[model samples]
Target chain A: MDMKRILVYGELEKERLHPVSLELLSKAKEIFPESDVQFGMVLLGSGIDGAVAEAQKSGVDLVYLLDDQRLSVFHPEYFAAALIQAVKAFNPDLLLMGATYGGEELAPALGIRLKTGVAAHCTDLRLTKEGKLAQLVPAFGGKVIGEIFTPNTRPQIASIKPGMFLASPQEDKNASLSILDASLLDSVSQRIRVKGVNRKELSSLPVEKAEVVVCGGYGIGSPENWNSLEQLAGKLGGAVACTRPAIDAGWVGDESSMIGTSGKSIRPKVYIGVGISGATHHICGMKDAGLIVSINSDPNAECFNVSDFKVTGDGNLIVRSLLEALG
Target chain B: MNIIVCVKPVPDPDKYNLLTIDPETKRLVREGIPTVINPSDKNALEEALRLKDLYGAKVSVISMTPLFSVDKIKQCLAMGADEGFVISDRAFGGADTFSTSYTLMKAIEEIGTPDLILAGNESADGATSHVPVQLAEWMSLPHITNVTVTEAFETKLHVRKKTEEGSVDYEIDLPAVLAVERNSNQPRMVTAKGMVAARSKSIRVFAKDDLDVDESLIGLCGSPTQPGELIVPNLKRASQELKGEPEEIAAQIITLIKKSGVAVAV
Candidate 1:
C-alpha cells in the first residue's frame, strides 16, 4: 500500500508552537495508525527556531518551514498562500489545523483555492474502508454529532477544536527539515492589511487555560456581587468566568471571558456555575468540562440538567458562605 | 452598491430543551419547534440594510432550506431586504458546509455578483463559520470573518475583526464576501409597513436545475463527508437538592468541593 501522507499546520504564538499543534500531532497518530502513514508539519512564521526545535521532538517525518518577517503577524491571505504552497509541495492526503481564529480563516480559504472539502471543528476523525477520512462534529449547538466526509475532494481537510485531543510528544530518531523560501509565495498578496492590534489583557489566567473555573450569571445580581464570586474562585485556586448575560450587564470584564457560543469555550477540570440559568449557547461552551456543579435559586434552571452536582439556593448567599467556610 | 446577505432559519434556541435526536435517522427532531431567522444572520441583514440606508445600496437575501423556510425568508423581506430567494430542493438535504457552499455559490452566480456578499459568522445550528470563506473562494473574492465593525466606502470596505488575543482592523477592496460576527449590529425589528409590503413581495425558489451546478456536487450524494454513528451525550446528573438556610447550603457545597479533590480548607 502507498503511504497516506498527513500534514499538520503548526500554529505559532510569539515564535513558540501553540500547544494545540502538539495535540494535533498526537491526534494524527490516533487517526492513522497504519505503518505506511507518514506525518508532516507545515510551520509558518518568522523567528521560529524554537518551534522548529519542538517540531523535531514531535516525531513527524518531515517539516516544511516558511519563516519570514512579513509572516510574523497572521495575515489571512499571506498565511493561506504559504499553506497552499506547502500543500502543493508535499501533496498530503489529509490536512489538519486547530479550529482557532487563524485556522478558521486559513482552512476555508484553502478549500476554495484547492477546490477541496473541509470539515471544521471536527471532534473525531477516522480512515474509512475506501480510504477516505470520516469527520465527526457537534451540530445544532452540540445537540447532535454529525458524521461528515469529503470523498471526491483530494487532500481532505479538517480543523480540530483545541483541547479536544491531548498532546503527547514523542521524539523521532530520523526526522528531516526543509526550509521553504517565503519569497516563492509572492503570488499571494496581503489584500487585507492589519492597521493595529489592541490586545485585551486578562487580569487573571485565561478562562480556557484555568484548571478550575467559577462562572457567574445574572443570578450573581450585580458587578459588585462579583467580588464574592471572585473571592470564592480565589479560595478554590481557580479563575472567575461569567455567562453572556453577565457580560452584557457589565458584571464581567469582557466577552472574551464569557462562556457561550459568542465567547470562549472551556474544558476545565471543574466548572462551577453560580446563579446561571443554562442557555444552550452557554451549555455548548462548558458542557465538556470534567465536572460541573451548579447552584441556582430557581430549581427549574437549565444549568442543573447538565451539572454533575446541584444546589438549590440563593447564589450570592451560598457563594459568601462558601468563601467563609473556605477561610 | 448591491449587497447580498445570506440568512438561515434555525430552531428557536429558547426551545432548545425540546430538541431531540432521532435514534435511527440521526437527525434533529424539529417538528414542533418554530423556526426563526438565525440570530447572527439577522445581524448580517441589519448590516446590509444599514449600508442601503447610508449609501443607497440594494440588499437581497438568500437561504438554502426546505420549502417551509419560505415564511422565514419573508421575515427577511419584512426586515427590509429588497428581494429573497429560497434555494430549496430535496436533493440538497443533509449537505455539509462544503456542498452547501457549492450550492449557495451557484445561487450567487445565478443572481449576479453583487458588489458585496454578507453572511452570519456561523449558523446557530451548524456553527461552522465556513460558508463565507469557502463561497468567497469559489467566487475567487476576498473575504473576512469575525468582523465586529464595518465601514463601507465608495471603492473599499474597512472592518475590525475579532481575535482571541485582540482585534485587528483591515481594509479590503469592494466585491468581497464578509462573515458578520454576532453583536455587530442590533437587527432591526419587523415593522407593520414592512410586513404589509411582504405580502406582494415574492420569494423565488430555486432547484438544482436552476443554476449551472454539477449534479454530483449539489447535495448529500455529492457531499464528500457522510454522517456515521450518532452519539448523544448522557448529560443527566446526580441529584441532591440542598434544603434549609444559606449557611447550611454553603457548608454542603464546601463539602462537595473538598470531596471533588479541591484543596479547600474548611
Candidate 2:
C-alpha cells in the first residue's frame, strides 16, 4: 500500500491549541483513509510547548514544531516564509488549515510560493474515488456550493471554516515530535512594521458566544425597522445579529456583528431570524443554532427550510406585533 | 507612482437568488446574471483614484474575466483608471484563486513593476480573499489584507488593516499589495464625460501567449484544484403561515415563542 502524508497547520491562540485545529485533526482522521495515510501537525509560534504537547495527545503520527520569538506575533512575511520552508522540507501530500484571518492570509501566500492551487473557506472536504481531495466552497454570492479539486497540484491545500467538523477521540498513539532548526528565520524580510493595534471590546453579549441571538437580514427593509427586531431581542434576552446585507446597509455596526461566511459563526441556543431571506452564506453561520425560528414575509424564503418553526408574515409588522404582545 | 488595482466582475449580488449550480459540472450557472465590479474592488479602485487625485499617479485596472466583461472593465476606466487590462481567454476558464492570481501575476509582470497594487479584500462571488496575497507571493512582494485606511508616500504606504479583534496600523515599503475593505472609500459613479473618454481610452487584452507563462500553469491544466461531485443543498423548511389579523397572528407567534422556553413576561 502506498502511504500518503497529510499535514494540518495547528493554530494556537495565546499559547493554547485552537479548537478548530483539533477539529481539523478530527476531520483529517475521518476523511483520509487511515490504512494508507500518515497524519501530522505543524505548530509555529513562540513558547509553543503547551500547544505541542496538546497536538501529540490528538494521536497524529508526527508533530513538527518551529519555536521562535519573531513568530509570537503574526507577520505574513515571516509566517509565509516559515510555512513555505516547512512545506519544502516535509513535502506532504495534503495541507489543511482553518479559514481564519491568519489562515486566509497565510494559505494563499503558501499556495503562491508552492505554485499550487488552494481552495479557501471550504465548508466540506472529501476524497474522490480516484483519491484526490475535493473542497466544497460557497460561490456566486453564496447561492451555490462549488465542489473544487486540485488534480495536478502536489500537497493539495484547503482552508476550512469552523463547526464543519468535530474533534476526534483522544487515544494513546506513539507520536514523534521534532522541532525544526531556525534556518528559515534568516530568510524572512519583515517589510511591514506594526505601528500599533487597537482592539474593540466585544459587546457584553457578543453574538459568537451569545446563548440566544436575534438576527435580521435584508428583508428587514430599512435601518428604522431595526428597532422592532432589537425590541424583540431585548424582550427575549438575546443579543442582536444581522446578515451581511444589514451590515453593508449600515444597519448593523461593522462586520463583527454580522453572521455569515465572511462574518462570525454562531451556535446559540436559539436563533430568531427576522426578515432573513436565508442565503446559503447566512445559513452556514447560524445553521448550528440549537433551534431556528424564521419570520419572513415571504413563505418561500430560503430561511424557512432550515427553520424548526417558521412564521410567514411581514418581518417588520410581525416583529412589532410580537413585541407588543409580549409587553 | 504606478498603482494597479485588480478588479473582478462578479454576478450582481442582488440577483444571487437567481443563481443555480450545474449539478453535472458542479459550477455556478451564471449565464444571464448581470455582472458588476465587486463591491470592495470598487472601494479599492476608489482608494487608488483618490491617491491619483491627491498625488500625481497612474491608476491601471486589471481583471481576469471573459471577453464579455469588457463593459465592466470599462466601468473602472470611466471611474478614472488610466488604463485597463483583461486577461481573458478560453484556457483561463474554471481557474480557482491560485490560477487566477498566477494569471494576474503574469499580467502584472508584463505591465511593469508597479509601486503598489490594490484589490478588494475578497470577491463577492468567490469571497476567497486570496488573490492579493497570492499575487504578492508569486512576485515575492509584501502584502496586507482588509485594509481600511491607506496613505501613500514616495516609497512606502501607511495603512490600517482590520483584524478580527479590531485594527492594526502598518507601514509597508513600496511595491506592496493591499486588499481594501468595504467603506474604504465610496466608489465614484461614471459621468458622461468620463464615459466618452473611456471609449477612447484603450483597454488591453492579454491572451495566453501575450506573456511568458507555461501552458501547464496558465489555465485549468495548470490549476491544481478540481471540482468533485457537486451536492445541491436541501434548503426546504416546514413553513407555517399565521392566519388572521396582525394582533391574532401576533398572539399565535407569542404562544410559539413561549412554548420554546423564551419567557414573555406578559
Candidate 3:
C-alpha cells in the first residue's frame, strides 16, 4: 500500500498548543483515508512540554519535536529553520498550519524555502481524487470561491484560520516522538530579534468564538447609534463586532472586533446586523451564520437578499426599542 | 540612506459591489471598476517618507502593473517619494504572488538594494500577506509583518509589530523588510505643488528587456499555485420580512431569538 503522510505544524498560545492545530488534525483525520494515509505533527518551541502532550493527545502517528532555548521567542529565521529541520525529520506529504499571526509569519517563509506555493487564509480544504489538496479560498472582494491547487509540488502547504474548523478531542493514542536537531539554528540568519513583548489578555470572548454577534455597519450614522447596538449586544449576552467604517470612525478601538474580508470570518449562532448595507466584503464574513437578521432603514439594502430575517426600519430606532424591550 | 516602498493599484473598495466575475472566464470582470492605490500601501509610503524626513533617506516607490499606470507611481512621487518606477510589460501579465514577488525582486535588484524595504502587510485585492516574506526569503533578508511602528537609527532599526492580542517590539539589522499595517499613520494629502512637480518627474518604466530575469521564472510560468475551479458563493436565502411598529418588530425579533435557542440575558 502506498503511504501518504500529512503533517500539522502545532502553534502555541500562552505556552499551550493552540486549538487550531488539533482542529487541523481533526479535519485531516476526517478527510484522509486512514488506511492509505498516516498523520504526524511537527512542533517547534522552547520549554513547551504542555504543548507537546496536547499534540500527542490528538492521535497522530508521530510527533517531531524541536525544543531549544533559541526558539522560546519567535524569530522568523530561526522558526523557519527549525520547521525545515522538522520537515526533514517527518518527510510528510502535506503541511498545514493555522493562519494566526504567528502562523502567517512562518508559513510563507517555509513555503518559499521549500519552493512550494502556500495558500493564504483558506476557509476549507479537501483532497482531490488525484490525492492533491484542494484549498477553497475566497477571492474577488469575497464574491467568489476559488479552488486552488499546487499541482507540481511535494508537501502541499496551506494556512487556515483558527476558527474555520471544529476541533474535537480525540481518544488518546500513543505517539512516538522524534526529536529534531537543534544545531540547525546556528547557520541560519538570525537578523530578526525580539526586544520586548506586550500581550494584552482578552477581556471577553472574541467575536470569532462568540455564539451571538451584533455587527454595526457604516450606516449606523454616529457613535451614539453604536451605543444602542452595543447595549443590544450586551442585553443579548453576545459580543460586539463592526465593519471597517466603525473602526475608522474611532467608534471601535479593538482591531479584533471588525468583521469583513480583511478581518475575521465568523460563524455565530446568531448574527444581528444594524444599518449594514450588505456590502460584498461584509457579507462574505458573516453569511455562514446559523441565523442572520439585518436591520436597515433602506428596504432595498443588498444585505436583505441573504438575511434570514430582514427588518426594514430606522436602524438606531429599532435597536433602541429592542434594547428597551429586552430590558 | 535608500529605501524602497512597494505599491499596488486595487479596485476601489467602495465599488466592490459593482465588480463581478465572468462565468466563462472565471475571472473578475474589472471593466468599469476604477482602480485606486491600495489603502494600506499609502501607510507604507507615509512611513517611508517619515524615514526620509528624519534621516535624509531617499525613498523610491516601485510597482508591477499590467497597464501603464504611470500615474499610480506618479501619485506616490506627489506624496513626497524621491523617485518612482513602474514595471509594466505584457510579459508580466497573469503572474501570481510567486512570479510577482520574483518580478519585484528583479526590479529591486536592478535599482540596487536599499537599507530598508517596505510594503503593506496585505494587499487589498489578493489579501495574500505573502509577498513580504517571500521576497525576504528570495533576497535572504530579515522581515517583519503587521508592523505598527518603525524607527531607524545608525546601523539598526526598531519595529513594533502587532500580534493578535497586543504588540511586540523587535530590533532588527539595518538591511531588512517590513510590512506596514493599516492605521499606522494618516497618509499626507497630495499638495498642488507636489502634483506639479510630479508631472515633470517622468517615472522610469521598465519592460521585459529592462530587467535581467529568467523568462521561465516570470509571468504565469513561475507561479506554482493555480486556481483549479471557481464558483460564486451561494448567498440566496428565503428571508422573512418584519415590518411594523418599532416595539412590535422588536418583540417579534425577541420571539424569533427565543425560538432559535440562542441564549438571551433579557
Alpha-carbon deviation at A209 in model 2, angstroms: 3.5
Model 1: residues with Cα > 4 Å off, grouped in runs: A1-3, A126-133, A172-174, A260-262, B200-202, B242-244
Name the best candidate (by TM-score).
Answer: 3
Per-residue lDDT over A71-185 for candidate 1, one digit per residue giving the tens place of the 0 to 100 score: 8777788888889889998898888999888899898788777877788888777667876566887777666666777766778889887776778766565468988877776
DockQ, per-model, please? Answer: 0.61, 0.63, 0.75
Q: Give the TM-score (vs. native) of candidate 2.
A: 0.90
Instruction: Please tell me which predicted candidate would have the highest DockQ against the true structure.
Output: 3
Which residue pairs show backbone clashes in model 1? A148-B225, A149-B224, A149-B225, A149-B226, A150-B224, A150-B225, A151-B224
Instruction: Please give the C-alpha DockQ score of model 2.
Output: 0.63
Model 1 chain B, poorest ten-residue lDDT window? B231-240
Which residues of candidate 2, in runs, are more than 4 Å off? A1-3, A33-36, A47-50, A88-90, A172-176, A219-238, A288-290, A314-327, B21-28, B242-266
Clashing pairs in 2: A148-B226, A149-B225, A149-B226, A149-B227, A150-B224, A150-B225, A150-B226, A305-B236, A305-B237
Instruction: Give the TM-scores of the predictions, in the order they appear.
Output: 0.94, 0.90, 0.96
Q: Rank the candidates by lDDT, best first.
A: 3, 1, 2
Worst 10 residues of 3 chain B by lDDT: B65-74
Alpha carbon lDDT at A216, candidate 3 = 94
Best by lDDT: 3
